[model samples]
Target chain A: MVDIVIPPLGEVEEVRVVRWLHEVGDEVQAGEAVAEVECEKTTFVIEAPVGGRLFAILVPEGRVAAPGEVIGKIAERAGGR
Target chain B: MREVFWIPLGRVGYREVLERQRRLHELRRLNKVPDLVLSLEHNPVITLGRSADPRHILADPLALEAAGVEVVTVERGGDVTYHGPGQLVLYPILNLRGWQRSIKWYIRALEEVMLKVAASYGIQAKRVPSRPGIWVGNEKLGAVGVYVRGWITMHGLALNVDLVPDGFRWIVPCGIHGAGTTSIATLVGREISMAEVSARVRAAFAEVFGVQVRVRDPTGLEVMAR
Candidate 1:
């Protein structure tokens, strides 16, 4: 269960959440496009790492998140009947 | 063209280059001689990281375009970074399986290569804890941002070398706003030739990664990177 954190680019400041491309309970695949943000408005897409059931957004849409902060989590489900 | 290859793109891409790398990867998966290397000079381009947004770029696209700079959104991880003519970009399509397949270890080895190369020019650089990349006095001297698929790496590091640091002012370097960057020449209080940096880095990479350094010209880079 690894948490996804933001990486440093040529940036030194924070960013405001522009949009969320997934909802809670949504399934994501590794390298699949997940969210979009304004890096000052460059409008690029963020991809998912490791496929699993995505948890609800921790940092909601329009919220500003700092670098290296965890935006979401992916946990494995238990029990096969 | 027979012995070595040289490609002067003059100014082109970020992700588009990766797309080209991908096609070669398919051939590589088929066991071909994609053993090539490229030294490119861009006309100023911006690339986004794996978990980054274009909004982090503080520069205006129209303004960048107005300056004749091409803006590119790349697939590599890390944040928005600038690449220009003064910045010598090296893309090695070498199989990392020949090196180590672990991305974390691969990045660390890249740090060693950059650090040793900087030392050759009388510059001292180090890596940050919990964070990867070479730093000089809190300012990054070189950036290690790459994309690895099935253990193959693309999109190598960005060493300041003699590049004008102000060019990085156009965007949030590696996505950290306000954090400044450093360069080899800047540290020594003089301008060093790009040729020197290239030579040192090539040697350092070969030493750090423990592989034979095969210098391939630009024309051979295409199939070589595959």
Candidate 2:
């Protein structure tokens, strides 16, 4: 199991989760964008860290997400999912 | 200090300019071009940011279309916003890789640039406690929404210069209610030329970001942005 958290946005205390590209039970490829987060200036997509199935979504759209806060959980896949 | 290439694209359509930003962003990511600051004006348009609430768009879809205003869903941050001729928009394709890398720092810098420009005109512009853009008294003077791809910035700030704020009534204007949008011309009680405002904006950007602005012919087609 792996955790997906909000990446640090320099000097920004928190970001709003703009949207989720992947839902629970969806397969996400490593480096694929799984969620979008909006900071002060820009809205950036957060990529999946590993190829796996999305186990859970802790942060939904329109919610504030702090840096290092886990937004979702992923079940890592071996070889291929 | 390093310099950012200043390209004045004059006036253009919003979608056309957005396409240029994407192309330049790719070149920036590959290091094929230096940092760029594109200054220009946008034709009338309404854009919905990544987290924009559709309800904020108060204009009827058919009416908006009949007026020849294009509505687009953009990838930038912020809520619903309006852009039109007479407004000055700056899109900085900066590689923040070595700089602060903090979104807040970058945003504050953009606001500071506008603040200084407004101050030069004797207009007192300030950043509200938690809001992201510059304001004059209770009216918003500027709006900022950006998209950073791999540390390269795009879809930047738009300052109301001489545009009639009537178009803004079609939308809620960044999700805020009651408050109004004011332009430099409106505050200064005179018509300010776009050329003059553009010059001040360039100087302010240099001062706030600690970079020099050197005018150069854009290498490619006329790029547009807002």
Candidate 3:
């Protein structure tokens, strides 16, 4: 499984998961924005690292998350969706 | 010198300007346009940033509608804030790829611009530690919220020029309760033209961001060539 972590937002102590763009069991492509997070001054879209099914969401909308926290996971795909 | 294009929309509605910003941002991301600073006044409106708490909007919906104030939820960061005539709203559409990639640096730079503008007007505006806006004593003088997609920015800072602070009671400005708001007019004890403040703000922004801002009319010859 590929971990979808909140990348470091410089000097931002924490960010809130604004929303999940995709749901668990949804097919996601590499570099697709799976979730949205907001720091103090900016909103960022967290992208998937690999193409697969969004396996789980560890953070939900409005929940605060820290840098490097894995907010989601994508299961490796064996074949076509 | 690095350049930022300046587009002035005299008095615009929030939704219209936001759509324009998104379109401009897409063009900027594709390298179709240079960095842009859009300066304008907004009709009375309350905007909620991406992570904004809805409770901060204290105005009743029916009353707000009757007052012609529209509340919109936007994609920028921060909480809730107000905008209207006499408030200069600046949306800097910037691509941070070659510029500063750190959001913190970008935001601080924006505050510096506002602080300098306030200083020029002889208002003692300063940054409160851990808070992301310009304040005078206990009152907020400016608010900032930004959105960056693929390192390109939109929805920048707003500086209170001559706007009445009473309207801000409709919301907890930036979600900070009891955070009184102030303006250049109130501090200076006189009315200042929006054009005057706009000019000063443009200069401060150019200086702080280290860019030569070329003022452009959307349909002017200079911009048409671009």
Sort by DockQ, top down from the best? 2, 3, 1
> Which ten contiguous residues of candidate 2 chain B have the minimum total lDDT?
B217-226
| Candidate 2 lDDT tens digits, B89-160 | 999999887567788888988898889889989999999877789987788999899998677889899999
Question: Per-model C-alpha lDDT, please?
Answer: 0.64, 0.87, 0.86
lDDT of 3 by residue, B110-183 (tens): 99999999999888799888688899998999988998877888999999999854579898888888669999
Best by TM-score: 3
Residue ranges of candidate 2 with Cα displaced over 4 Å: A25-29, A77-81, B221-226
lDDT of 2 by residue, A1-81 (tens): 889988777867888888899779999998788998998758877878889999999989889889989999899999633
Real A-B contacts recovered, model 2: 0.87
Which residue pairs collide in model 3, if any? none
True contacts kept of 1: 0.00
RMSD of each: 7.8, 3.2, 2.7
Per-residue lDDT over A1-81 for candidate 3, one digit per residue giving the tens place of the 0 to 100 score: 888898766777788888899978999988777888887667877888888999999988979999989998899787522
lDDT of 1 at B193: 84
TM-score of chain B of each: 0.85, 0.94, 0.95
Candidate 3 chain B: 10-residue stretch with minimal lDDT: B217-226
What is the CAPRI rating of model 1's predicted complex? incorrect
Candidate 1, DockQ score (0 to 1):
0.06
TM-score of each: 0.68, 0.90, 0.91
